[model samples]
Target: MPIIDNPIVLSDASLVLIEQKKATANFSHANWGDEDLQPVRREIREHYRNVQRLVCVYCLGSVSAHSAAGAPVEHIVPKSQHLHFMFEPENLCVICPDCNEFKSNRESLVNPVLTANRVNYPRNSALYRIVHPHFDSYDNHIAKFNRLYVECSDKGGYTIYICNLNRFFRRFGRCDELVNDVALAEQAERFFEDGIAPEQP
Candidate 1:
């Protein structure tokens, strides 16, 4: 899938709350889950769950439709390190619990120099080493064969590695039932035969 075409638009009340939180004397990532922000967080999760079609951005697995715990809001640039971007719409998306756990607090930027001291979030896809759910197309960076994932670019490799996309394979071992799809295998073969080169990091 490509970048989220429509990011969540916060209501005025939500924005006010965010602004109030930002203005606090000792604001930190811990404030993210404050009681006042619970509604906003739920809205974010619901919006992204629909927008992402109930699919995890990292591994394309099914996300829960009935529970917020099934799909949690993800900060493309971790909020722990960059609290200023905690509510940036472009930095938000929904990911499955596995991707959320494996990718916890890991740096996603391609170059820290570009983000240091910056007031605004980076808009350019090149600034991110991982496949950006907001700026990059998932298929352009990674190709999938059933449960197996193949990297088509540096961003793909970084995303797969960070999220451990192959965890299922590692746990169950490669079985014909998982990788024996003739159509998918042929499509993957054609993807390589087309001479597509990985994007340079």
Candidate 2:
């Protein structure tokens, strides 16, 4: 499934607040936590949590349902770098804390050459190095085998690396209990074959 099937829709009040914030000369990402925006943040978290089926967009880990902190609202493009996109729905998603920390403020653009010239948020998957939660299908770029994530493409590899998708394995050494499931392994192997096989003309 795609990470985010639908983007959050802001209410009129929320839209007004965001616009008002942006109009201010001192507006910055730091204001993301302002008390007035808490309601907006909460709404975004709940919307994405449901749309992403409570899974971290990067590692596919289960998102915490008990608390808002469990699933943080992620800015695909670091809000600090592009404060203009802070309220962009396409730029937002909810992810597990581990993935969030690992992916913090890293460059996500496919072309570093365009970084300085960037003015608008990109909508094309080809413009991103990471698997875009909204624009790219997760299965097309990555395959999962039990606890392991296998990249189907460069974007998938970048996503896995940037997010430390194998964090569990790194923290906990490989053991019999962590072995890949036989059925899932077989499926993953087929996926690898399909991913690498040359397309018929």
Candidate 3:
């Protein structure tokens, strides 16, 4: 690995030079990345498959679930801003290439906090109530549709506005099964929670 030279890095000059170099080197072509460097987004598929099973929550399907076993992991928070969320385990979810390339460096992903049955945008609900996978659960906003596409929660609607899920979903059709799966998973989680009987705080 190469250590960055501190003296060679000027503050403003460094940010600009780095941005230009990264863009040119990575996005030489709209969808292509520089062969020489690692594609940051590849973390979606690479890490999950290494440790855990890459199953589609909606379809309950494995990598083999799709025609190809090469689905890329998507950053619900978009790695561009939440660089911290870049490699978060909860951020890793299996999605086809179409969805991946479409949603690049975007934001406004819905948090699955109190979402059940269907995701709802409770933006008017409260503050510090932001959507975060590591801190929150996707079960709130992401619903698995008939093994088709992922449905957005009420709050998810706001998220899609930013991420352009509408435009994308139009092409893919309704993700009824995906939504149902999320509802089922949420129910199970609730059952386990209630069944366990939490210790009083």
Please write out the lDDT profile of model 3 over residues 1-201, one tens digit for every residue. 001011111245434443554455343323323343233434334544433344432223444333333565655555554443333345445554544555555544434333322233222332212233234334455433333224335543444444444553566666554456765556445545654221211
Which window of ten consecutive residues has the lowest lDDT sum in model 3?
A: 1-10
What would the per-residue lDDT of candidate 1 be over residues 68-113, giving only the tens digit for each residue?
Answer: 7788889989999887789999999999999999999999987776
TM-score of each: 0.90, 0.88, 0.39
* lDDT: the better of candidates 2 and 3: 2
What does the lDDT come to for candidate 2? 0.81
User: How many angstroms is residue 23 displaced in model 2 relative to the true structure, after the best TM-score fit?
Assistant: 3.0
Native-to-model Cα distance after best TM-score fit, residue 134 in candidate 2, in Å: 0.5
- RMSD per candidate (Å) reads 3.6, 4.1, 12.5
Identify the runs in model 3 with alpha carbons over 4 angstroms from their true place. Answer: 1-44, 50-52, 56-69, 81-94, 109-133, 145-153, 159-201
**Model 2 misplaced regions, further than 4 Å:** 112-119, 175-180, 192-201
Per-residue alpha-carbon lDDT of model 2 for 17-108, expressed as tens digits?
88887787888999998888888998889898889888888888888876978989999988887776889899999999989999999989
Predictions ranked by TM-score, top down?
A: 1, 2, 3
